[model samples]
Target: MPGRLQHKAALITGAGSGIGLESSLLFASEGANVLLIDVNVQAAEKVQKLIAERYPNVKSAAIKADVSKESDIKAAVDKAVELFGRLDVMFNNAGIMHPEDDNALNTEERIWDLTMNINLKGVWWGCKYAILAMRNNPTDASKGLHTGGSIINTASFVAIMGAATPQLAYTASKGAVLAMTRELAMVHAREGIRLNSICPGPLKTPLLMDFLNTTEKRERRMVHLPMGRFGEAIEIAQGALFLASDESSYITGTDFAVDGGLSSCYVTATGEPTLPPPSSLA
Candidate 1:
């Protein structure tokens, strides 16, 4: 049998590492033609090569792009369309969280601006170009091309809940992403395009590990996880896979929380579920 995304085409930003790289591999494995966009050219190329070797039947490419630049994002999307004949999924996953991004009072102006630029503005650009491209896609099934596509933005658990360890700029940017995703999803709901955001909790990615280099720091962050551990990148990628495929056709304008139930926690880290003693039934 064919894969879930048998004939789809997807463009993934930040495709060089972590969640992005994992998703790129997963999407290709599921039979989607993928375009891997990243600032790290060599890293993207490496993954692209891996895809070529592992999934020779899958069409894929690695393109260098700094998501902070609108021109670069636009060009990358355009190139994907030119190469694949249509755009079926857009995964805007590039973002940053700096160790210096403390509370509002301590966060540097440069850091604040940089975080918003790449995280917030970058998502907007990706959505903008994707909407434009998908709107007039020559391959629309109605016009003999593919059906409407899915757009996934990488927000965070911080977007919905407050963090005492305040990476203020990161939180703010993600909050903005959630807001943008909702409005866009509603606006384009009737146009065959689906827009959604994935809010992830702390994950075992280099970005998070590097920020929490010390065991003390890592432990502090882990204490709040409902799963009692950091999530893996592939776990989050699997969520994206569902949204990108037709399985989630009716889902849009929503935030898919893939944080291992961390966002649902109230007081303590999650543990085994409690069950009533069986003697009462007798």
Candidate 2:
């Protein structure tokens, strides 16, 4: 049998590491031609080479692009179309959590602007161009490929729930992403397009790990996790895969939380999880 995303084209931002890297590999494994976009050209190229070797039948390429720059986003989307003939999935997953980002009084204007530029504005540009490209996607009924595509923005659990340890700008930016995704999903509901934000809890990725560097910092958030463990990047990738594929055809405009019950918990249980975290493919 063919893979879930066989013959589909996907463009992923921040493909160098963390959730983006895992998603790129997973998407390729499922037979989607992938365009990996990242500021780190070397990292993106490494993933592209791995995809070429592992999933030889699927086309994969890497491009150096900063998600904060609109032109770069447009170029990446256009490249996906040029390579795969259409864009079926756009994962606007690139974002940052500045170490300096803290409470309103402590966070600097530069930090705020930088976080918003990449986290919020970058997602906006990705959605804007992806929609334009997806609008003209060539339909192929036999393969289940359609004109409209799915867009997944990486939001955070903090967007929906408040965090005592504040990364104010990061939280605010993600909240905006959730809102933007909802409105866009509504606007394009009739156009066969789908938009949804995937909200992830604290993960063992480099991004969050760096921020929670000290043991005190780590424990501060750990006390609240019902699972008693940080999530893996691959876990979020699985959620992105479902949203990208037709399996989630009925889902759109929703805040799909892949959090480990973090958002829903009032008081976390005290034990560690028996099940092991999902292993990374990258």
Candidate 3:
């Protein structure tokens, strides 16, 4: 049997590490020709090599492009089409969370701008180009590179909820991404291009763990996690795979929360006794 993303061409940003890296591998395994674009050329190349070795039939390429630059994004998207003859999925997963971004007051101008450039503006560019490429391509179910494909933006659960531990810049950028995804989905809904945002909860990625450098910092957020643990990058990648495949044909203009119930929890992580606690004992 053919894979879910068979014959599709996917262009993913930040494909060098973390969720982006995992998604690239998974997409290729599912029969998509993946274009792994990242600022780190060596890292991207390594992933491409690994994909080639593991899945010799899967076509993939490592493209060095900083999402913060619109020119680079355009070139990356174009290269995907050039390489695979069409574009089917666009995963705008590149983002940053600086240590300096404690809150709005503590967040420096430089940090805010940097985060928005990559996380917000970068997403915009990716969508713009991906839509343009997809709109023109005729959907061919037989070939598996369907017309007007899926665009998955990587937002965060922080976009939907306020956090006690604030990374104001990161939060703000993600919120913008969610809003953008909704509007873009609406604009292109009739045209057949589905736009969606994946709002991932705190995951065990280097980006989050490195920022939460201290055990105390990690524990502070852990109390809010209903799952009692962080999510894995592969988990988020699986969500991306669903959005990328034809399985989500009717899903668009919505945010898919791949969080560990952190966004829905009202109780504190303190494990304090509640009125319902007595029922649990019974």
Candidate 4:
């Protein structure tokens, strides 16, 4: 018996914590050789240790990588292939929220640039190098691994729906993520490389907790949520797993929303267990 990602190699950025950490662990459970990349070296090592303890049967590595930096990205990718012999997947999950609360009108030039560099440009770099490395892999006839591989990007539901909050820089960066996914999907579709974005809704991750600690802010945020609760990192990891595995062979240039129905819900649609029938009396 073989696993869903048996014999495959995966390089996941932001794998130090939250959704990235959950994804790296889940991928290993499914038989992927995971390379955990993070800007925080200690956190990455911590996750790597946890993986080793839990999944002794699978191979895993950790590398400190600032995804916004090209040299760091290159070194991490190179390290993965050097240790694993091939690259089959790239999960570009590293991203940041703007340090300031800047809307389009008042958004600081520096903040916008920083957000775009990390969120958008980082994915572009990951796809560029991952595609190159995957193309060079030797085809394994046994598992029908003749094709290159897949790329999963961490986008946001805000990319589709305008922010119910105040972060413009994050919105713009994630919008670029959706666009990049589509364009990259088309560009390398011929190469058998699939690229898609995982647009997560509000999650109970430390990143979110750090931003919305106040009771007022947290309550305000929770009201808009149809599910009335934040999602878990593991829930989003399952979405990434679907995209990373052969399961999504036909999926590309798409935004897979793992937002607990947040992206698809409308304000008026709330509290309705079912839709009303067509009004014949109207």
**Highest lDDT scorer:** 2
What tens digits encode model 1's per-residue C-alpha lDDT throughout 1-282? 688888788999999999998999999998999999999989999989988988899899999999999999999999998999889899999999998988979999999999999999999999999998888666645433455689999999989997757689999999999999999999999998999999888888899888888888887777787656677788788889999998999999999998777777765644653432122100
Pairs with backbone N, CA or C atoms under 3 Å apart (clashes), candidate 3: 139-147
lDDT of each: 0.88, 0.94, 0.88, 0.85
Off by over 4 Å in 4: 268-282
Residue lDDT tens for model 4, 1-282? 777898899999999888888888889888899999998989999988988988888889898888888888888889988988889999999998754746778888898888889998998899889988988888988876765899999999989987867789889889989998899899989888999999998888888877676798776677667776777888888889899999899999999998877776765234532422221100
lDDT of 3: 0.88
Superposed by TM-score, candidate 1 places the C-alpha of residue 40 at a distance from the truth, in angstroms, of: 0.6
Candidate ranking (lDDT, best to worst): 2, 3, 1, 4
For candidate 4, the 10 contiguous residues with the lowest summed lDDT are 273-282
Question: Which prediction has more favorable lDDT, 2 or 4?
Answer: 2
| Tens digit of per-residue lDDT, candidate 2, span 1-282 | 788899999999999999999999999999999999999989999999999999999999999999999999999999999999999999999999999999989999999999999999999999999999999999989888889999999999999997758899999999999999999999998999999999999999889998988899988898888888999999999999999999999999999999898898877767868668976798
Prediction 3 TM-score vs. true: 0.94
RMSD of 4: 6.9
Residue ranges of candidate 3 with Cα displaced over 4 Å: 268-282
**Clashing residue pairs in candidate 4, if any?**
none
Q: Could you report the Cα RMSD, in angstroms, for every candidate shown? A: 6.3, 0.8, 5.8, 6.9
